[model samples]
Target: MPKVRVHNVTISLDGFAAGPNQRLDAPFGDGVGWGDDLHSWFMSATKDAAAGRTGTDVEYFVRGDRNIGATIMGRNMFGPQRGAWEDESWQGWWGDNPPYHHDVFVHTHHLRPALEMNGGTTFHFTDEPLETVLRRAFDAADGKDVRIGGGAAVIRQYLRAGLIDELHLAIAPILIGRGERVLDNLGEGIDGYRVSELVSSPNVTHATLVRR
Candidate 1:
């Protein structure tokens, strides 16, 4: 079976996964801003003059996204929207074609209908537990890989639960002062994993971990 993985989750030197006060304009938070400068490496590496991905980024991008059939993300990662949603008009942060061209299970507090978007992306909202959600995602994956897409809190949940088999982090070069930190309260639960691969570039440091 394909391992549960995480890729390209950019973080500040201070360990902040996202900056504070996320809104329509500043989705990643006021610090990183909506543009997500942390993920700038990915954006620059993938896009070309043709207006779409056309380069070595294709190999890396495909390896990260195409190998997976489904993804699970926290509600906040889906959008800056909070509470009861107020309405269903909000699809997600990505307009029309989302980056995840596969089934995406969004963990939410409030119940919402499944959202079908352009490309192969489909969002399924659920308030289920970690195990329940992963089971559903793996089932939807149809023998392909499943990913626990993150925004810190959710990743920590599964990480502590030993749900993730492979983990990748794109440690960006910046500090957001105060925001959501990815390594908070992990304690010894993090000891089960060990770094298996690492690479360095001008943009960022790519670290891949595997369970020991």
Candidate 2:
């Protein structure tokens, strides 16, 4: 069975995943943004050391090439909200090439055509239900795992639906004070989830939770 995993998702000490006012300029939050907190993780996750030995942290950061077959993310995670893209010109913040080289699905209310960028990455927009998107992602992933690359809201939705099999979080050392909290008003706590692994670096602590 293909597992649904959420990996390398960062959060603040105050439990906020992103800041209150999210724009292109300030995507994460005020002063302390996602960039600052996630710089090490990103560098590690995307770095290919052999070429020049990018960074040591990359060894800790997880990649999709292993068992992951597809990726699913919310519209907010795809790009900064320019208020419903008037055109498909925006490829994303990763420039001409994106990190995700597999099938990537973006959940949105509005529909847009599939975007094929450099490498094997292809972004598909869907206005369907959460379950529908998951099904498509699973199919795209084949028999490998599917990653839910989130923007908090998307991960919350999957969590509430009990669709996530595993979650890997990188707890940063900053405090946002105010922003969009990841675990808010979910009614009851996550029943069958428990921390399975914990690792730490100087900047961030990585924790893994598995569904029982």
Candidate 3:
């Protein structure tokens, strides 16, 4: 069966997935000491791979993209804009050619037409329930897997609904005093998941959890 999975989700030592005050200029938020070096090991690995480097980080980073046919992310991950999207001119941060080369669903209350970019990526904005959107993603994915490309909150909702089949967390060695946390207030929602694997590199520790 095709699985609903989250991969390469990086969090800080303090459990913050993103910094406080997320906005246009500051994508990960302001006053979080975010820079080229402050990103997760997976981010660094992407750059390193381009420079002909290979390591554990690169290995896991590459694994995240394998067999992912569709993506589901929150509105924040699509952009920093909020409140009904007054302007539809913004085409996301990835420019004309986005990274995702498949159907990318953005979870939002406001409705918007499907956006077809230069690459194979098509952004579908919807306010549908998690299960409904996920079903659409599965249909688009065919027999491949659906990735939970998140901004924390959306992932939490799927977790709460017990929709996720697998999750991969890359814990960075930094601390964001205030921001969104990836694993908080789940209560019994996370009961069905278990840590299936744990590995560490020089910059981060990787943890893989699967439904028990």
Report the C-alpha lDDT of model 2 over 56-129, residue by residue, as the tens digit. Answer: 34554534346988999988888876457788788887877887888999999878899998988999999899
Clashing pairs in 2: 44-58
Tell me the spans in candidate 1 whose CA falls farther than 4 Å from its real position.
34-37, 48-60
Better of 1 and 2 by TM-score: 1
> What are the TM-scores, per candidate, against the unseen true structure?
0.90, 0.88, 0.95
lDDT of 3 by residue, 1-212 (tens): 89999998888878888888899888888655444445746667988888989999898888889999999999999998888878799889899999999999999988789999998999999999999999999999999999999989999999999999999988888776888998989989999999999999999898999999
Consecutive 10-residue window with the lowest summed lDDT within model 3? 31-40
Q: Which candidate is the best by TM-score?
A: 3
Cα lDDT of model 1 by residue, 47-123, tens digit? 65237645443444446775788999999988878898888999987899997889999999998999999999999
Predicted structure with the largest lDDT when compared to the true one: 3
Q: Per-prediction count of colliding residue pairs?
A: 0, 1, 0
Q: What are the Cα lDDT values of the candidates?
A: 0.82, 0.78, 0.89
Question: Candidate 1 versus the native: TM-score?
Answer: 0.90
Clashing pairs in 1: none
What's the CA error at residue 125 for candidate 2, in Å? 0.7
